[model samples]
Target: MKRSKALKVETMFNNFKLTFFLQPLHGLPETLSDTANANWPWQQDINWFLALAEFKRLTQQPTLHFFLLEVWSEHTRCLALPLCSTKDGRYWSSLTDVYSPSFNIISSTTLIIANPWQCLLHALTQLQPNWVYCQLSPLRQEQIQQLTKLNGCLRTHVFEHSENWLANCSSNQEYWHKRPGQLKNTIKRKRAKLLSSGSRIEIHSQLTDELMLKYWQVYQQSWKQPETDRYFINWLANYSAANGMLRLGLLFIDEQPVACQLWLVHHSKAAIYKLAQDQAFDNLSPGTVLMADMVNYVIDIDKVTSIDFLTGNDNYKAMWMDFNFKLYGAELFNINSLTGRWLWSKQWLKTTLKTIARQMHHLIFRARHDN
Candidate 1:
């Protein structure tokens, strides 16, 4: 029987049946809330997927086709793969967005499932014969390495996305001391100037209804690009505020809102989610001053272990968050499809050429060193 793009796979992986459920966790035989292998509950649990579904709905984004691939050994489930296919049904991805910090696939660490990655690929290949690509992203280096190393697909390629920045806060004094002198001097000068110019500035932390109104007002006047979904940011602020994770900071100049930043604190880590500052306040450097104060607040007041400047490799980010972890993504290609085949070959050739170039450079370096 010919299968459609939304076809399900019921393949056997060494006797373990790989079943794809059309619904979310409700379709699963058992909840993975208490799964023994769940290290990162936020990323791996059933609730996270449900939240993503709700987020999409609330944001009015196109609904994705959710897939719950459960691997069962006899009647006991070994692992579950939570996946979301795009509206076009050609690409498979995680239930993640720009806001999602990371992604994960729950698997039993104790279970000796030989070549589970291969089984996953086989099942996907059979289910979506015309599948062009797959991407699971915002993953750490270890996570990316695991997928690429265990990959059974010949055309899978790994790509570095960004250098996610982090600030280790031993203390406010220590953290500030390590900062570049130029940064400190600029903030000091700009802040003093703003104050002396009779521009009374105030920074607020609460996401109250009044503050929320001021936030959107200033954000519109800011230099930052417009958000694709404006409602999602507002929703995120409310959600984070309810969870006591919202650290939405608004900077005002004489009662007029000039700058606003969206930050979230959770699990003893503070993330700099979003920030916007009015271009009219560029001379005052409200962004820089606000950031400095926020940093001090997160460390001395909030007592967060670390401050994450998530999802950017901006030059200024390096000055504040000195330490960084590289985030990566992988592209999986199907050799059976013509477009996929070309993509695979091109990627292969690019990789091989890079390898050759590096080897040649190494050889030349060695000969030069001998001289």
Candidate 2:
């Protein structure tokens, strides 16, 4: 049976209504694909990797529900977001972080809900989800704040999630110019040293099957094991072949492969999915050199508006990226229920302990320095 519902929301400015349909990935839906591609551009589109069959085969979690949420005006659909929920009514999280770097509610334009938090709470209350709660992950502060403010029944918990780095530039020259002077000089010096040693770096923007296999081989030489799922890799190979969105860059020393990066690009945005380099070539700074080369490709040739380092605050990312944004996780607990109350109490205790620990550490450090 097709499960669907519509709710009307009265905002101060306008009366907004939304339609939601349950999407079971028994097969790929054109509507799902169209909505994903149309709305989300900067982030990786979910439709690219997981199909209905794949999702069913991989995610064996019980009580799972997938929703295609559409906000419609009188004539046209204004916004759409995909949501997953557990049987107990909790938002479905990733089986592993490597599988999905971020979870988001996709929309083409900035969401204009007169009071998004209240509206969302009202919808949830009406739906009467099995569990007294749901949690959305990998959102920024501003996005989480919009959903955190609810009335009496729902309590919110926001956790420190991940840090992402990004560089916004029009051209390679402009990118280099934006970097700190010291870092710029260091990169230039490293490039000069590698070139002087007869080592050449190459980027394979055009991904052929053979070339992709080679890229994987190079990655294995440096990393412990592949963090990405096998199914994901299979999907990526097929997707890249058809879409031409994968960019693999390799650094070579006298024709020997040393470092490799797998980048995914769509529309005008690009993200570094994975990067690895041979430990033996550590002295050559192959990873850094390869990154520099990839940046040029992303900006100069690909003409990407931004490059996301994706979910890390590593020192190297700071060197290249001018700014960063925070990703947060929000858990909405039902204050009316016992289980929800217990969970909230435990969460509160954890936060208090963490705060006390930080204060103690600061005091100890101050005491030592003062002496």
Query: How many clashing residue pairs appear in each of the predictions shown?
Result: 0, 2
Question: With candidate 2 superimposed using the best TM-score fit, by how many Å does residue 312's alpha carbon deviate from the native?
Answer: 0.3
lDDT of 2 at 152: 70
Candidate 2 colliding pairs? 63-87, 88-131
Q: Against the true structure, candidate 1 has what lDDT?
A: 0.71
Cand. 1 TM to true fold: 0.77
Candidate 1: residue 83 lDDT (0-100) = 74
Candidate 2 local Cα displacement, residue 216, angstroms: 0.9
lDDT of 1 by residue, 88-119 (tens): 55777766777676776666654567666566
> How much lDDT does each candidate structure score?
0.71, 0.65
lDDT per residue for candidate 2 within 1-371, as digits (tens), equals: 23444434423223555643334433352324554444232233546424423554464533555554445445555454455556444443322234456765544444476664465445554454434656766777787887676667777889888898988888888889888888767778888888887777767656576776666667677854753345555555455445656788887778777788888776788888788888887877878888888888888788899988888778878888879988888887776777777788888899899999999999999999999
All candidates: TM-score: 0.77, 0.77
